[model samples]
Target: MKKSKWSAYLAVIMASAISCFWAFWGSMENFHEGWHYPTLKENLTVMAIQYLSFMLIFILFSVIAILLPKIGSILYFLIGVAFSYWIFSTRSAITLSVVLSWLPLTLPLLLIALLFWFGEFKNRKLALFIAIGFPLLICCTISIKMGVRVSRRFHDGNYEERIVKGNNDVTLVWASQGPGWPKESIDWAEAQRRCIYLKENGKELADTPQNIWRLPNIKEVTSSLTRNGQNCQGVWNPEAREANYSFPPDKESPLWDIYSPIIYFWTSEEKDKDNAYIVVYHGGVFSKPKKMRGSVGFRAVKSVKNR
Candidate 1:
């Protein structure tokens, strides 16, 4: 009976440790990369905050498991089940490989819970091996790959340009690029905030004025397009209008050339009570609400209003 009780305690400890490690590792890695331009002090502050937050959660989990072993094991099992659903729900297109990859992140917690609940049944060693081994392997492999990719982008000069001065009549300033894949993309409101930041900060050039720039209207956004080489079409909806870049890009539009990959931008035009027009540089165009979030970007336009 002593051995049995000890197994339950050990299982609980292992489960908490592995779960905390996975959570901390994933959160820190994404946090490090998302705000890529943070100074050393800012980065350290963020890390400290994240560490404290996760550590508190970890302590709570440990206490629960220590005080109520059976209930804690059940809770851990439920968490694992919920996480399985979460992994699939987050996928843009679910497939076998995606499901398989996500399993490593959650399976260990489930296995540890099972061990605690059943008191070390047959094949427990195999279960333990799987619980511990898979996450470590996957986490290390992913970390190395992420480090390499970030380093390559740093050296390749692929960082998005912050400000691009257009013709003297109007100036175009770049907005948020967002946190890349597997995260909520910059929405229309956030994009607008980026523009406001630039305008107030002189577009990082030390001389630009503030409050003159604003989110461009549908007409103004369309007017900036230069159909230099390819056919362009004006796509209109009841609430808004957009110019499609078609299959070939407009070599003339400087904005299009820079953000050629995913040049979707939000316009100030409103579509009904909620939706607004979004201009796409490559994948045609459509409208969505200001609250709707996606990978859309924006360019703040500034000019003297006609008298």
Candidate 2:
């Protein structure tokens, strides 16, 4: 009876350790803000959610330890392995994904497996030590590696040169296309406000008159074609072109590649008091109601006086 009780206690301890690890892993960002009480107070909902998740994980592990050690161990182990495999399989960079995603997914499962094994092992104390010690070593190792990689990327000058500006009045931010694209989609009012905010914050366009940094009309948005070359200024409205008709770029619309990330941008042209036009550089143009939202991005343009 004493031996069984010792085994159960050890299992609970191991499960507790795993649950704690999961809690910290999931809530590290929220917990980071807790260093400032005001920030924690401001993020009360997030903090509450983090705390709730931790408690739920703790309860789940504790129950599994007590009632269904063997089955629970296998279940969690398989879950962890499957999750880790899925992450590694889908990732382009396996080593980075293993450090950043796989271990977090599987570490809890490993702990659960060890917890169940504790009851079955003749040397329960040894099993307990191994379960706790091994995961700690892995956690420390990955944490150090991830920190170093992130810090290196931040310090590297390569990250600074993301934006590519054209000879035209318009310029594309580095997130102009492909991955790392901006995910903001705002209404005309909000879009105009954001442009104003950017301008006021000294992100003004060069060689343009003051107050010229505002949202472009449909015509102005289409003016930055690669075909326009050095003369890509103002809006370029196609003659009687269908709203959805997207044509291949000649010199007239060479901007299709330069602004590839521009899936949709809010144009200053208002369809009504509530609806507005959105320009899709490659996909064609469409009208969006004030209420409808999308993953559209915008670029600020300024007109230049001819030399």
**Winning candidate number (TM-score):** 1
User: Candidate 2: worst 10 consecutive residues by lDDT?
Assistant: 152-161
Q: Say which candidate scores most in lDDT.
A: 1
**RMSD to true structure for each model, in Å:** 11.8, 15.3
lDDT, model 1, position 16? 52
Model 1 residue 87 lDDT? Answer: 81
lDDT of 2 at 84: 75
After superposition, the stretches of candidate 1 with alpha carbons farther than 4 Å from their true spots are 1-33, 37-115, 119-129, 154-272, 276-289, 292-299, 302-307
Worst 10 residues of 1 by lDDT: 175-184
Prediction 2 TM-score vs. true: 0.33
Q: Report the CA-based lDDT of candidate 2 relative to the real structure.
A: 0.48
Show the colliding residue pairs in model 2: 162-174, 163-174, 219-235, 220-235, 225-254, 225-255, 226-254, 226-255, 227-251, 227-254
lDDT of 1 by residue, 1-307 (tens): 3336556646755765664575557644543333243254654465446433454454455446555556767877887899888888888998989978888878876876665665533444454444444444644565567445433331223234334332223335433233211123467766555555453333342233344445676654544454443224333343433344333333234444332223466877666767777866443457777786545656655543210
lDDT of each: 0.51, 0.48
Query: Tens-digit lDDT track for model 2 on 1-307?
Result: 1235465566666665665565456444333222123232544565446443653555464565456667666766776788677777787776864676557556756766665655544554554454445444544554455334322221111222133344335554322221122234555676665555443223433343345345666655554433323333334445653332223222122232221223466777777887887776433567778666654655554443210
How far residue 215's Cα lies from its native spot in candidate 1, in Å, is 3.3
